[model samples]
Target: MGKASLLTSERRNRSARGTQVRRERVRSAWLFLSPLLVGLLVVAGWPLLRTLWFSFTDANLTQLDQAQWIGVENYLYYQDGAFYGVLADPDWWNSVYNTLFFTVITVSLEVVVGVIVALILNANFKGRVWVRAAILIPWAIPTVVSAQMWLWMFNDQFGIINYLLMGVGIISEPLAWTASSSLSMWAVIIVDVWKATPFVALLVLAAMQMLPSDCYEAAKVDGIHPMRVFFRVTLPLITPALLVAIIFRVLDALRVFDLVYVLTSNSSSTMTMSVYARQQLVEFQDVGYGSAASTILFVVISLIAVVYLYLGRRQLGISS
Candidate 1:
């Protein structure tokens, strides 16, 4: 009886020691992470809260100090038997449509092309090192610089794009790629795909590299076709990486301003939500209205991100 009691006490003591060790580790982790948490609060949280606050007031760029609280007037105000503000504005809806269209198209194209490029890059070939380095050149270039370069290439007169198209008899003359409303969005999309595809490719390539090689070897010994192997074996393994890439690209594309603004300026055809917010904030000097738009944009992105992650988790069979 004494020996049994002693064993129970020892076990209890060991469990207490383990629990104390875990507590210390958790405390140390939080202590190390406190600086980063503080920085994020100061940098992002504060600004977001300020923006939300500003959205409820009648603020302007020049008279920000004298701004008055107006409640939801900037979002939707009822006056004189009518509705108004950013919510009722046709231009705002147009910008929302433009933003969604760009996000969907760009992300789809980037993912498809990126996966193809990643597959090619993963294969063993001569001069593979140089090819891998060269593929990243477009992504490495500054967005502003790339946008400006493409602007010139898209010029109606004496541009290389037109030159090559005419050379191939694709068009009779130089087309106004960035000037026409019909073509401006396409031009912006092209430049974005060129610049961003490399980033997705790199991510997918890294994921592919980490895959176990024995599966491929075993499939090869079984005389499986390459396409079949890719569909059945390779694709399922790399889906998580693809999901991450898509989420990142979707987030980035939704908030796109620089590429569109630089490429198409204030053209309504290519004006994203960010561009619309900038126009209201900077050009029109309506801080409250702009802040309202920005808040909506933030909410929309957050909701979409949440929905996407939830769907992704279900697809991956991850328990909540």
Candidate 2:
């Protein structure tokens, strides 16, 4: 009886020590993370709060300092019989449609092509190292520079793209890649896919490289087909990495501004949410209206990210 009691006491003491150690570790972790938390609050949190504030006011570029609060007038109001503000604006809705379309198409294409490229790169082949290096060249180039280069290449009069298409009997005449409403969006998508596929491939390749080789060896010994092994074994293992790639790509595509702006230059057919906000803020000098649009964009992105992570986690059977 005495021995059992003593053992129980010792076990209790060890558990207490373990609890204390865990507490100390958590405290230390928070201490280390405080600086980064503070920096984010200063850099991102402050600007976001400021934008939210500006959204509720009648602030303009020239009179920003002397702005007046007007409630949610910039967002939506019904002073007249008809509705007004950003929510009711046709152009704003058009931009929203364009942004969503771009995000979906680009992300889907990038994932498919990136996975294929990653699979190819993962295979043992001659000049594998050089091929990997070359694949990343498009992603490494500056966005503005790449957009400008594509801009010139997309010229209908004298461009390599048109020349090739014409020479190959694809089109009888030189097609206007960027100028036409029908083809402008496709042009942007093509450029975006070309540039961003390497990023996704790199991510997926890293994930693939980390996978255990023993699985493949065992599958080979069992005489399992490569496709069957990949679907049943490899794809499931690499899904988490794919999720990460998809989320990152979605975020970038949703907030796409630079590439579209550079390629189309505020064209109605291809103008995204970011470009619409820019037009309001810079061109029209409607600070309050632009802030409202920017705030809506922030809310949309946050909701999408949250929902995506939730769905992804649920699919993976991971507990929050």
Backbone N/Cα/C clashes per model: 0, 0
Candidate 1 lDDT score at position 88: 96
Give candidate 2's whole-model lDDT: 0.95
Q: For candidate 1, lDDT tens digit of each residue in 84-136?
A: 99999999999999999999999999999999999999999999999999998
Each candidate's root-mean-square deviation in Å?
5.0, 5.5
Model 1 CA lDDT for position 301 = 96
lDDT of each: 0.95, 0.95
Model 2 per-residue lDDT tens digits across residues 200-235: 999999999999999999999999999999899888
Which portions of model 2 show Cα errors greater than 4 Å? 1-35, 318-320
User: What is the TM-score (0 to 1) of candidate 2?
Assistant: 0.89
Model 2 residue 267 lDDT score: 98
RMSD of 2: 5.5
